[model samples]
Target: MKKYLIKKILSNNVVLVEKNKKNYVLVGKGIGFGKKKGDFLEDPKEIEEKFISLEGLSDFEYEHFLETTDPKIIEICNKIFEMASSELKENLNPKIHAGLIDHVNLAIKRLKEGIEIVNPFLFETKLLYPVEFELAEKAVSILKENLEITIPEAEIGFLALHLYGGRGNNDKEDALKHSKMMNRILGHVGKKLEIDMDKYPFDCQRLIMHLRGVINRVEKNQSLERSFVSKLKDEFSYEFKIAYDISKIMEKALKIRVPESEMGYIALHLHRLNSYKH
Candidate 1:
């Protein structure tokens, strides 16, 4: 199916399209047609492959994406590349980069014909919920803005930690206190660097790693709740989003193309104790 950049979604399922020239296209019933203008819609089934476009991804993400992956991902990556600006791309690590492209493609595809996430335990989650979906979304956005990457799936889980009540008893007071604790530590560190951890463009990989380490101290020294380590682990999943951002910051600060995605995966494995023993 060839796509058209919608110049005008006409009345009676008709649209004005353009490809070098403008024309009105009719979407006939029983014979579906999706065409547009300005939108570089290629009929791979019709003609040969030519120049590919990156519509949504940043420069760093595009460079890494083009280096790896097949043309299929590229088609999707093109949209991502186009969507992102060069400045945004400069900050992504490959892992965050890869995850961003892959998930965005999947999300857009699913959403197009109407789709949704269907968890079997959705009812159970709603009943004795451990995490809030909204908070997870917030976490994911924060990860993207700060880390120069985004993973909608994992952040949902990370933010959902509020439902689990994260280490302390599941109470508002505890949540507020933990928020303050994390913020205070970040604030102090930010001050030393003449940067606000709250505002700095550091990846979550280093941030979470630092946080997880501090969490260990809390649990060990104070007989903190058993859930603390679990909380840290949950938060660790968000590192994928952050590490990608860190790559850019590192590149800017250190002038290095440090295999951002690889570092993110390494951090993930470390967090799960998958290969590297703690």
Candidate 2:
């Protein structure tokens, strides 16, 4: 039996322990209560509800997170991770630990300050990642229960994105980058149309989902049929022009050329959006 020695106590529920020359962060209820440095912990597996291996993780970032973030927030994140792991039935990327804690802490702060950010990709996210979205709904419930605050629906989308990114073998950065690019493109669309996209949530969601499909097709070098291109270009010249400009934006951002066939599809969506403005 390997004996675990406490290296440091992050909070009442979190402690850094050393076993067999390996360091791990142990998390559970009162795992660190009355614990001191160099204290030996017997049967760590019996007591620890969650254990995070520090291997290949940035020490400075972990230390900074522990030093700066609220312990209550950390505890909540642990619970979220536990629930996610059980529901997902797989190991999540460890990188999400800091990201989730930071995001939740900031979200709570923003909500308290009455600063709410509208998530433009909410509909697309929920539609694409149904499992993660469901998990995010539960996560919001946990947040509401523990913090005694009402989390907005928009936050659920953000949480869903995080949960989707944290899933096994998924790159968190890529998930975030995809959403960010969509936001930029939507911002440009709103600017070009000279209308607030938020006011037309359904139309905006349709446009976002269309863009997501376009991006997927573009990345895969897949081409849509060109049968409607001429008709769309001739019938909705203004929307087609805006869609062309959006193609240029996508080309620059994704480093992939947008096919003209796909541009027609985008124009079709834009034409619908244009009607909503009337």
Candidate 3:
């Protein structure tokens, strides 16, 4: 039997361990209790679960997640991703590891405290992504079985959105699409308006994040409330035109009409970017 040094205790049952210069997360009842950093695993039999960090989970982000999150939460998150990967025929995004654990932990806490937060996008999420919705429904079963907690039906749709975004293929494709769209928009503005946004990398990054949210909303057919489109257009005509051009691209690519309110928001961001350098 080999002794593993405890690096951190995430919960009473979960500990980050280091052996032979590699990191592993161990989960077992009482495995982490009474343990401190540099303490050896007293008994191997106490180990109920282990995730090898060297294998497909070496990123510092995952390491930090394993170190900070509860073991049971991590276990449940792993199970959800395992089931989703097998059912959907795609690898779930590793980043979802953190998000799911954090979400489910808070959700369990919220329910225990009698909080009832509604998922506003539940209907659209279910309608737009039926397959992921089904997977999330099944996930609720796993939660009920293991966590012994009943989640709201709307939670299924919320989980579906998370799972859908975390699918590896879709994640990569969406990233590529986002990058292409950002470049196209910047190129269009650079060529048509002759503004070099490359000089403002921070502003460009903010715009990228904004576009990411826009793409996600468009993909899910989510729209904002009506806004003062005419006033916005009048006040920020140049930025609004750029926003309109972006709307055209989004409409052409996603086959959904871009909402004027969303365009107004985009124009606001565009105006900020334009004002930064002009």
Candidate 4:
């Protein structure tokens, strides 16, 4: 790759570069030091942090972001996206660039100012978006290493939300609501049955997978009739009752009625988990 010129300085570490007649935004510590427009970097190869802009498209948000946001913050978020892309093997939505930069900037500012906020859906976020949560964890570590800032765990949850929005199909807020309901239902089952959910990883995973599918079905209004629901209820009364309790919570949390078949499937999972000795 040929070295690019400094077309403009967006920040102390961020600069606009042109290569092969396409514009790119480069971010690195001191990459833009004492540089002016039309001044080519002696080693553009040294600019390891950069994102290519969509060809011939005017991304006003990205442009405004480069001008207004801190380059260090942008650099941090870029590493996160790079990590996510590498791990997930998918191209994240470029639209997330500006939004994530803005979020990181504000998050850092709030942390430096000693203001803290809690994420009510933190647990749910971890369970629901495991991969994204991992990326967020790495992002926090990077911030600590580069900026010497210890971000709150709640911010990691928030960053996971941003990553989920950037990669997944569900609306970020709706996904959080769904995950919260699922966790609440699982918690209720464990309490009612007096079972240690951690002891039965397979059963727990099964329940989570079932509930995830249930959410999709419910959102699509796809009704599934369960002919064996009554039989299962009679055979496993305890698990059936726990399932009923979970159904109520889901109904309340999701504001959608859960079908008996769905409850029956969930009860089967609960039965298996409760029956396990460990």
lDDT of each: 0.39, 0.80, 0.71, 0.77
lDDT of 4 at 153: 90
TM-score of 2: 0.78
Candidate no. 3 TM-score = 0.49
- TM-score: model 4 vs. ground truth: 0.72
lDDT score for residue 136 of model 4: 88
Q: After superposition, how far is residue 84 of candidate 2 from its true place, in Å?
A: 2.3
Count: clashes, candidate 2: 0
lDDT for each residue of candidate 4 in 52-89, tens digit (9 for 90 to 100)? 34343466854765666777777777787888888889
TM-score top scorer: 2
Judged by lDDT relative to the true structure, which candidate is superior, 1 or 3?
3
**lDDT of candidate 1 over 20-106, digit per residue (tens):** 432323232211244333444444532212223233456575555445444344343433332332323332222233444444445
Model 4: number of backbone collisions: 0
Candidate 3, poorest ten consecutive residues by summed lDDT = 46-55
| TM-score pick, better of 1 and 3 | 3
Ordered from best to worst lDDT, the candidate numbers read 2, 4, 3, 1
Which tens-of-lDDT digit does each residue in 1-278 have in candidate 3? 77788888877866778877766677565777888998998445546234424344556766665555556776776678778889977777655555666677778778879999686545434544568889999998998899887789967866776787787545523433444555567667656556676676666666666766787787788987665888988999988888889888877765677778888888888888777555
Stretches of candidate 3 off by over 4 Å are 1-5, 11-13, 18-36, 39-70, 169-278
For model 1, the stretches where C-alpha displacement exceeds 4 angstroms are 1-135, 138-162, 166-172, 196-201, 221-278
